[model samples]
Target: MGTIVKQNKQLYKAISENKRFSLAIFICFMAILKIQYSNVESTEYLGIADTKEININSSHSVKIRNIHVIPGQTVEEDELLMELERPDLDLRIYELESQLNELKAENSFNSEMNKELKSVKVSNNENMDSPLQIKINSMTKQLIILKRKKADLFVFSKRAGVIGSINVKVGEDASPFTPLITMHDSAPSMIKGFIHESIYNKTYKGQKVVVTSISDPNKIMDAVVASVGNRIVEYPVRLRKSEASVTYGREVVIFVSKDNPFLIGEKVQIKSFEKPNEIMTAHAQAVPVRKIEDVIDLEIGVDIENTKVEPSGLVYIKDLNQTVMISDDTGRKDRPYIYTVNNSGLIDKEIEIEGVKAISDMEAISMDENGIIYIASSMSEKKNGKVSDKRKKLLMIERNDFNFKAIGEVNFYDALNKVAKSNKSEEWAQVLLAKGNKKIRINIEGILVKENTMYFGLRSGSKLTKDQFVLLKINDIKSVFAKNAIDADQISIQANVAFPIDSDFKNEGVSDIALINGELYVLTVNNTGKEGGRVLKTVLADPSNHMTELKRFKGLKPEGITYDTSASKFLISFDQGDKKSKLLLVDKF
Candidate 1:
């Protein structure tokens, strides 16, 4: 009986040992298995790295109608590269030239007549200074201008190089604002590679890069990183098993020796790649803050000329077929500033309206469907970002034939202050070292009337947190007015829109706002002067969504943007400061 019991105990111990050994083997196998290993480290990209090149760009939108040279063709200095077709511009040039020739012929005749008069000793000095002489001088000036315009119709190469690449073909609309062709010199070839994202942070300009021929790993060359791209793009050639996400990388150009044997756009391997010591990235650089003024100049562009003062507001009245521009100057008897400009680029007339109180500084103007012109003055002192101790100004006008007469007036200070006080402005959110000394004042820079609602644009807001904008609904505007005066605080206001501080462009909130083709376009300028501003657009259906980039402005301080259906482009006005204010018409992107 004892021996049988001992045998049972031995069987139990052997079974326990076998179970523990099996569990240990299973655990060891599981430890060696890879569940979520990343292939980002092993990825490589194929890119063009050969030839010294130059990208020829167009500064304006134009249609390419002629290609003078093909790729691989050699070109000389001042050689014709491409011809842009601008039918309207060409027509204008022809007209100007024709008018100039006619003037020159008349001037010649007048000169002969004057010589004949001198020979006859005609004593009348008045005859010598007749309108013909004046006209002759004007025509000579016009001829010189017409000749310059005629010469600008063609594009020419500044430096001689081979046509490496052509981005445009025959009879296509091409915007010369971007690179249209590449001209490359016969210099030593270089290598360009798209670094894997996992190792992208380790790359930088002036860093060492190892290049090895993919076909033969033994052939290798040491190079330096020449440039790092700011944009992410797809690999030109896809590897056999590269995933879609890993296929995208920042283009990196490397410097190669003159005798390098790598073909232009060849595949190569980079060795000894290590993660970067530190990675630096930013949405945008912070710029300097500007001083605030009582009257912010909302420079609205118009097709008008010979105005006495700077234009602050603009409105296009369809019924009268006229565009109205108002001055940023104080309404005084001496400075008559309200003007009506015809679409033909002529200042048709000026309107004189008597003010009940004061129209010192009008910053924005818009026309309603009922032919009523709405005018608004800036409420915040931009330097201090403070609301004015006085009332904000608002005015409405109705044009009778060519006469623009005032229809109503309002004090908007209370309403603007109320909206500003509700939120804390994030002025320092973008600046590196600026003191937040003043409260963010809701400065209404622009106004739009849509579906019985008024959307006021706040030009000041901290980025990443709250961007500034407001929507107000006014019921029975005419009924709300009493004796040509109204209180904007009494209107029914909707929730205001404030952008968060996390946007790529954390510049000053917005300079102006415009509704174009069902999208709201907001213009922002760098207050800290760290980076150029951006024109952002958002769909009306979802204004809460982050606005996407539409246009970018650098050096050119754009004050306002408006869409012209007649031209199908955006007209941007720049602050000339004290110089002649200018307007630029850019293609909408």
Candidate 2:
């Protein structure tokens, strides 16, 4: 009986020990699995370092007529790269043109016949919408549409880039689905990457990341996260650890210096530095806070020019205690003169620019410390898409006593061509000369002369991207503009710097620029007919720093800005459409 009881106790003890040991092993297994999962959710992510691709295609079936550019050729924005034509489209256009001509002849004959009849009035024939007139109008519309279609066959580069590939031959038949040409941005400033969801919360915009080349780890660079996607996206096959495994994460874009030493389409590994809270705090603090105040309209007028003042540039004249304002020669009929307005908003004097055959497009005005005045034209194509010689002059004026006399005029076209060629930026001059669209047209909207250096601010955004604006500098202004005939070689191109554009005001371009106490302020106008603008602040020395919007105005088209040192405020000029332009004093800018 004693031996049986002892055996049962031993069996119970042994079973309890086995259960405890199995529980411990299971716990250890789960801990090991957790560690492996954490390792898979790594800080490193596969990234593609490449320039943005711009694919050029045709909307309809067409045959290539000519190819002007070869593969790996550098092209300027709006440069004619290829020519294409469709036989079917040409035939349709020809038929429409014939129909239009026949209708016009018939309409003219009918009008003459109606004049001979007593019941039909000659005025009625002109105003009445008869069946023949309706037919003519419809035919005209059709003809215009067909002609526009034919014009699209001529392919122009939409941006400045290098020709990546030409997919079709010169005489190959291609459809809308076929990409005729591929262009890659000349600068690889961005990297595309993805992050796993498990560590998404730790990553943020503006965070510093170290990028390493997969094949050569020694080639590494530091970059900043420009943006992060809002939603999760499936990882690309190249980024996945296993080809068959599916995974998702958020998209991220990293910005690097334009001169980074990396080849396009190279595979890289990006490791994020864990600093989410710190980065968010820094970005939030960078934005400046200000209130939008009411624009105090100063009823200013220049009566010598009966037309609307339509002021485009303004500069403060302390010697005369007045402001000198200039109007753009957009109408091409107005007399060119700079009018000095007193503090009371009345024209005190009119100074005419001598030795010029006609009024030029005076877009900006600046005054040096020695009282030398400089007036800059738009230096771009006319509003009618025609090239004008009168719009390419930069006049230098000297104020003697109370009169401003024109000293000399610089041929901007010749000077810019020389500067661009020397700097290997012939594309800049090409874009300025291109006349089809206004968005890419290079216009000088702001001029600033400080310490003998001249800074010309561009009104158009960057040709490659809208997220940047350009400022071209000319060192030693006196050496460039001769007393009589200026030579192109005398003009010194110091630098062509691109500043970060303010993204808050979408589709807005620089209308004017002013410098006060070494800080740069720019006024941008909406190009979408919204009749509004924003005042932004930036530093010229640091082009990488983004601009901050100081103030935004609605229902006003701000065209000019000048800082009043004595008053300690900014004076802005506006275009009032039918009414004369007025000046506004912004107390806090």
Off by more than 4 A, model 2: 1-302, 329-334, 418-441, 461-464, 483-504
* Deviation of model 2 at 269, angstroms: 84
| Alpha-carbon lDDT of model 2 | 0.70
Candidate 2 lDDT over residue span 541-589, tens digit each: 7643657778777778888888777766678888767755666776786
Which residue pairs in model 2 clash with each other? none
Go through the candidates in order and give the clash count of each.
23, 0
Candidate 2's displacement at residue 292, Å, is 15
On a 0 to 1 TM-score scale, where does candidate 2 land against the true structure?
Answer: 0.45
TM-score of predicted structure 1: 0.39
